[model samples]
Target: MSFIESHLGDARQRRRLITGIRESLRELGLHLSLLNRQVSSRLELKDIDVDCLDLIDRHGPISPSALARSAGLHPATLTGILDRLERGGWVARERDPSDRRAVLVQALRTRNSELYGLYAGMSTSMNQICDGYSDAELQVIADFLTRSAQAGRAAADDLTSG
Candidate 1:
């Protein structure tokens, strides 16, 4: 059975599990956002700059439209972020090889070692934490986090639409 499917809990059990998960996710988000803000400030960048640059690093050679959608920024806002990053030598905007009309943004990896180092400590700690979990347990954790993020996004969309 799939990870989620294997949890054949009753309704109350499921509800309790979901409540705990949501609380944990919220706390996690809050803590990470705080940390990110601190790091971004130290790097002399606005929070959105770090956010956009991180997105580009994760999905570089990525089209502006997709980045805008993923970042939840308006296209004009994304263009401004791209302009700032390009000017700072943090990112590069290039023409899409497959689509001349499209612009792709990529992180200038060599220019951002300090940014990467700032997260290394936390990443290492998380890796050590995960080392305590067995493969199946890790799979369950991964699946739960993934579903929780999707649910959170869906809820946010619902709120914005109404």
Candidate 2:
């Protein structure tokens, strides 16, 4: 049985566990936001700028339209972020090889080491925490977190659309 399933003997216990999960997710989001803010400040960037750069790094050579969609910002706002990133040597705007008329934004390797260095401590801590979990347990945790992120994205979409 799963840890939660094994402990859920009654409806009250289940409700309490669910509430705990909800609260934990909220706390995690707040902590992550604060961590991003600290990292951005160290990089002399805004939190959203770092977030956009991360998206670009992960999805390059991606178009500005796609980056704007992923970042949930309007195209105009994304232009400003892209400009800053380009100026800081964090990213480059290049003509798409497949579509010469199109432009793609890609992360530059110049500051990538610095960015990774800032995240090394957190990466180490998370790896240590993951080491305690069995493969099956880790899979379940990953599935849950992935679903939670999807739910958050859907909820955000709903809010924005309405």
**lDDT to native, each model:** 0.86, 0.92
The lDDT, on a scale of 0 to 1, for candidate 1 is 0.86
The CA-based lDDT of model 2 is what?
A: 0.92
Question: Which digits, one per residue and each the tens of the lDDT, describe model 1 over residues 1-162?
Answer: 665666755656989987997788789999999989998888878899999888899888798899987788789998888888888889998889998888889999776678878988898999999999999999999997888779877887777566
**How do the residues 45-126 of candidate 2 rate in per-residue lDDT, one tens digit apiece?**
9899999999988888899999988888899999999999999999999999999999999999999899998889888999
Judging by TM-score against the true structure, name the best candidate.
Answer: 2
Task: Pick out the ten consecutive residues of candidate 1 with the lowest summed lDDT.
Answer: 3-12
- Which ranges in model 1 have alpha carbons more than 4 Å from their true place? 1-17, 159-162
Q: Kindly give the stretch of ten consecutive residues in candidate 2 with the minimal lDDT sum.
A: 3-12
Off by over 4 Å in 2: 1-9
